[model samples]
Target: MRLSTTQGLGDEPPETNAASSVRKKPDGAKKVNIGEWIDGRYIIEERIGAGGFGTVWKAVESKREEFVAVKEVRHKWLNSPKMLNYFKNEFKVLERLSHESTVCPIDLVRGNGTYLIIMEYLCGGSLSQRLRHSEPLEISTALLITVRMLDVLKACSRLKIIHRDIKPSNILFADKSFEQPKLGDFGLACFKSELLALSPRAIGSEIAGTLTYMSPEQLNGKKLSVKTDIYSLGMTLYKMLTGRLFFDPELLSRAGIKRAILRPFREHPGRYRPDLPYWLDELVMNMISVEPRKRPGDPQAVLDVIERNS
Candidate 1:
């Protein structure tokens, strides 16, 4: 990756470079001008969103004549070695995973110290946006979405990939039709073998996922497995069904969170929407069980239970 010199950005631009091609923001970050070509292929369009890791942009691949989503690692975050590793690891995981419900990366490119990950562009926004814009989802729609996610989980289990972060933002509709949901953002995902390699540090290492959707083990920084994803999935389902988080943010102290998580959860799907089937409530209850052992062993089992009960 060529590092472009834009001053105080730790990179030196070419000695004879023309100023017209690069535009620097006030914050010292270089912004890709709309219509500018990246890596001689993708044309920058508009920035879509940003998160802890980086900014995402909607771009077009001129040669392929297709629209794509490009995620760029922030210049500030690139200073951390761990963050760099995470960025590369996300590329690896995305390259390895491909399923109907999983949004996998198509390419990773670097230019002037900028790392960009190209992904399939989804016209419909994230599940989080959907939830925020509307009332609680209908039970049928929620179930369909959850079932498809479960299928993705089952595929992940077979592939030995554990998505450490499973939340609403990572779940996206493939298009405006909203018929296909694709799970993206794998920066926190790690292979099961990698977790085993890091077992010594797993117990007390810093947590690496969203707290609101974290599994108990994840919040505690314990060795993770597929069950971790299941717990988050349960939380995601709860929000979809209730349009509210199960745990109140006010009760986030160590003891408070532990107590709330450990205690048998009493709220059911029917509590929010009386029309939902009791079976859904039962499935979610089993999934959100505080003990990892208590949750369904895998997404396959969860799907089977759903089918048998429905």
Candidate 2:
């Protein structure tokens, strides 16, 4: 689909986050400007978000007259064959899971010294933006978002895929109305088998996810289960209800984060929004319980509660 470059911080795919997370250096890739044509089909509209690995640009599909987001690999990574393969592999994972809540892949192009992935352009700005400007979202709004997200999580679970990163920034709305909650950015997702084989000693040595929403088990690198996602979703729910993070960003060190996770989590959604009913308050708490066993692993169970509350 061809699309124009709409205003606002467009939905950022996982590659954008990956690019910025890597060492800050010039991303050595060919750059294209506005009005430039790509593959003689899509025309570059504007640079919406930056990714060192694959910079995302808004483009218009000339044939279809629709909007699409294109991600182009940077120059420095061309020699590394693995990067290209990695991009293709992750896209395949996303490309397979088709659903209304998931981002749609339009095209994957192999240009000279670069790779480009075209995705559905999301214009409604992310849930993060909602919290940034106005948080503690309406009770009904939060519940609606949670219910829809539960479906997306269930879809991923059925395929044995674990989206390691499930944060507000990754939850996007299709339009400014914020009625549709679409999940994007699967850069850190993994198949269930990938973690099941990891030995205990290797678990904590390398974990990939946002620390703020990471569950204690994930932070400690224990055998990941569906509960890993439960904790992150609960954390997302908390932010939506209270407009705050479970832990302060200052707790970035390994020891500091571990201690925070192990400590008793005293906060609850009801604490901030006194108007919240007891069931929802309890639901959020149970989902984010420090112990993996305490968190409900069933997405439908959580969805039921959210629907009831909504």
Q: Give the TM-score of candidate 1.
A: 0.83
RMSD in order of candidates: 6.9, 6.0
Give per-residue CA lDDT, model 1, range 1-310, as digits (tens): 2322221122322232112322332243354556667767778788899776667889898898999988877555454555666777888877777787888677887655566788889989999999885478877778788898998888889889998788999999977755798888887788888774233133222326666777777655567888989989988888898887667756588567656765766467667777777788888888888788999998988889778876
Estimate, for each residue in 1-310, the C-alpha lDDT of model 2 and write its tens digit.
Answer: 2233322222222232222224322343345567877777788898877532456788899899999887765544445454445466557768878879988887666543356777899989889888995468887888888888889889988988888778898898999876898987775577787655333233223225666777777666677877788888888988898887666666468667767767876567676788988998899899989887787868987887776766
Error of 2 at 101 (Å): 0.6
The per-residue C-alpha lDDT of model 1 at residue 181 equals: 86
Kindly report which residue stretches of model 2 are placed more than 4 angstroms away from their true locations once superposed: 1-29, 51-53, 73-86, 196-207, 250-258, 308-310
- TM-score of candidate 2 to 2 decimals: 0.81
lDDT of each: 0.74, 0.71
